[model samples]
Target: MLAIGLEGSANKLGVGIIQHPDRSSLEHNKSVTIISNIRHTFHAPPGEGFLPKDTAKHHRTWVALLVAQAMEEAGVTVDDIACICYTKGPGMGAPLTSVAIAARTLATLWGKELVGVNHCVGHIEMGRAITKADNPVVLYVSGGNTQVIAYASQRYRIFGEALDIAVGNCLDRFARTLNIPNDPAPGYNIEQMAKKGRHLVELPYTVKGMDCSFAGILSSIDLHAERLHKDGKRWTDPETQQPITREDLCFSLQETVYAMLVEITERAMAHVGSQQVLIVGGVGSNERLQEMMGHMARDRGGSVFATDERFCIDNGIMIAHAGLLAYKTGFTTKLSDSTVTQRFRTDEVFIKWRD
Candidate 1:
């Protein structure tokens, strides 16, 4: 069966097609195959964040073209597709609507069912499919959410999450302070700059129980950036009494934030009594965080599973895979109830596809 997925919950617009093997052909638990995955991002200028209005406009402009391209690449006719999938919630209101409208239109025009997928669940299912990380603790860190989740009783139960401000949001704002370009991504540029840094300046580390906080840390770091800004980017390191470089601040922020994530992820693993860890979402692609998570998992005689940028960031293939999983079990979103939302919780979804 073929599923076409649309995802435009943020600055990026993506469309993909995935094929599910016939039940009799399935082997070794593998289920879905990516037929095509194409994406386009609306990049804000340097030192700026993308606004919802502009992002939604970008999506509306590109959604049709991306769908066409995805279809061409997948080599499938409308008749070959069994369903249409789209991200329905837990994202920017306007962007989510833009994509959902496209999904609804296509499903109506093609006479196919519509599968509305939870954004977080899309990431989890994609991670599981790619890494085969069965029943691992999930560390889902993205621009909007920071959550440690575990599957139980047909639900992805949240064990921990950010109290305020996601880790990726913190990084993006910090990149703005340094006027980093958002072409590839502000976070990606920051990660690159962080590699050149030698000093790890002190920053507030907030971890309470299983949940963590990044708002306070962002404020404190912003102040440090302000000080440097006033001095024309010439500030001294407080701990070493040496010149503070942009790279130093980038390095410091990543270390502090990633350490907190690793800590909470470890706690979740222990709480769930799981030895496997799976990292998902855009921020989960960070190499340093992956390394830190690897060290933590290894020390506990476990391992960390992570995907490259293809699966790490927001994309439609994940939506298709997840949506298809549900669609196979007779799940379909009614057209009248296909409206998008900005605050859908991950735990709300009932995982009927998993045993």
Candidate 2:
């Protein structure tokens, strides 16, 4: 079956098309046919700090183009698609409404069922599908989230999460302190700086039980930056700085944050009695984090799985795949059931979404 997925929960506006084999799980699992997948994106305001109206407007303006691009890449027309999927909630209301409206309209036109998907579940499912990791602990970190999750009874359970600000939000704030570029993603610039920064400076590291707090860390960093500026010390370019480089800071930040995530993930694994680990979300794309998780998994006689950018970062294919699974299990939302949620807990969804 062909499915078209729309993802506009945050900064990106993506459309994806994927084909699922029409057969039982056993039959489909045994077959190795490469199902086609294609996607396209539109620029959303950087920093993931855009206003709801702006994000929604961007979505309304660009979704059709992205869908068409995905269709072209998939070598199929809109008529070939059998189902339509969209991210439902745990995101900004205006943006979610924009995408949902688009998907609902398309489904109406094509006579297809509109499926609502949890954005986080999409991240995990796509991570699993791409990496083929079975029962792996997931560390989902993004602009608005930082949580340790795992699959249980055919649903994802949140074992640990940030108590305050998200890790990505912390990184973005740090980038702003350094006056880093803000387009595309602030995390990217921070990553680049961390790559060139020297770890001559020590930053606070804090992790409590399975829950972490980034708000304190961000405040501490801000104070430190203020101190540095007051000292009349010249800050050099992260790319060209010598002696102690910005890359060192980048490395330090990546190391500290990723270590926290890895530590929490390990804790979750031990608590859940799961040996395998999987890293999801945009931060999962960081090579340093991947390496740390890999080593941690290996030390425990397990393996760590991470999805490529295709699934690692936010996109539509994952949403479509997750929505497909939900649809197959008779999980449907009535029109009256629609509601946008900014802080919907992953574990809470299991009660209503589990098969």
Candidate 3:
């Protein structure tokens, strides 16, 4: 079976095709193959996250081109596709709507079934398939989400998340505050800085049970910048050295926030008694995070699995793979049920098929 997956929930427009063998012996709930995955990101302004309307415009203009290219890369035709899937939100509405419309139009034209999959599920499923870490605690940190999850009753359940801003947003804002180059993602720039910096400035660390709050940490950094400006200390000038540098701040921020995630995920693992840990989403690309998780897992005699950019970060292949599973289980949403939502809980999804 060939399936096309559409992911336009944020700044990315991903189109992926997956081919699955017909095996009646295999359970419907089993994860399957990924044929070819392709993704195209829309242009966003520096010092800002994705804007809903602007992203929507990019989707409408560029989705067809991207999907066509993906199809070409996969060496498949539209007629060969058995089903199409699209991200049905917990994301910005405009981009979600754009992808939804594209998927709907294509499904109608081809007379194929359309599956609406959750954005977070796509992330975790992609990570799981690539790593083969079943029943592992998941730390899914990205631009729009910071969540700790575990599989339960055939669905993934989020045990902890940010009450305010996501960890990625906090990092991006901090990168912007320092006038850091925002191209190629702020996290990349911050990671470079953390490697260079020696000083470690203490930052606020807050974790209430499984939930975290980043707004206070962001405000603290802003206040620190104001103090530096008032003291007439310029990082650019070598003579006027400040007690804290942007590099140190970036390092501290990463250390503090990621520690919180590790603690909460560890707690979830204890609760679930799962030995495997999987880190998904864009921030999972950070080597520091992977190292930290690896160390923690080693301490517990458990293994931590993380995806490379090919699967760890957002891509079309994961979405297509997830959509195929959902389709195999006869799990689908009607066109009317594909409404965009900003905050859909992960545990709210009911898994229909169990092996």
Tens digits of per-residue lDDT for model 3, 284-304: 999999898888888988999
lDDT of 2: 0.74
Writing each residue's lDDT as its tens digit, candidate 1 over 6-28 gives 99889988898988885333331
Please give, for residues 97-187, the per-residue lDDT of candidate 2 as tens digits: 8988898888777777777788898888777777777667889998789999977775678888998888987887777776666675678
Structure candidate 3, residue pairs in collision? none
Clash totals in order: 0, 13, 0
lDDT of 1 at 194: 95
Index of the highest-lDDT prediction: 1
In terms of lDDT, the poorest run of 10 residues in model 2 is 25-34
Residue 344, model 3: lDDT of 74
Q: Between the candidate structures 2 and 3, which one is better when assessed by lDDT? A: 3
- Segments in model 1 whose C-alpha atoms lie over 4 Å from true places: 23-29
On TM-score, the leading prediction is 1
- lDDT accuracy of residue 180 in candidate 2: 65
- Report the CA-based lDDT of candidate 3 relative to the real structure: 0.80
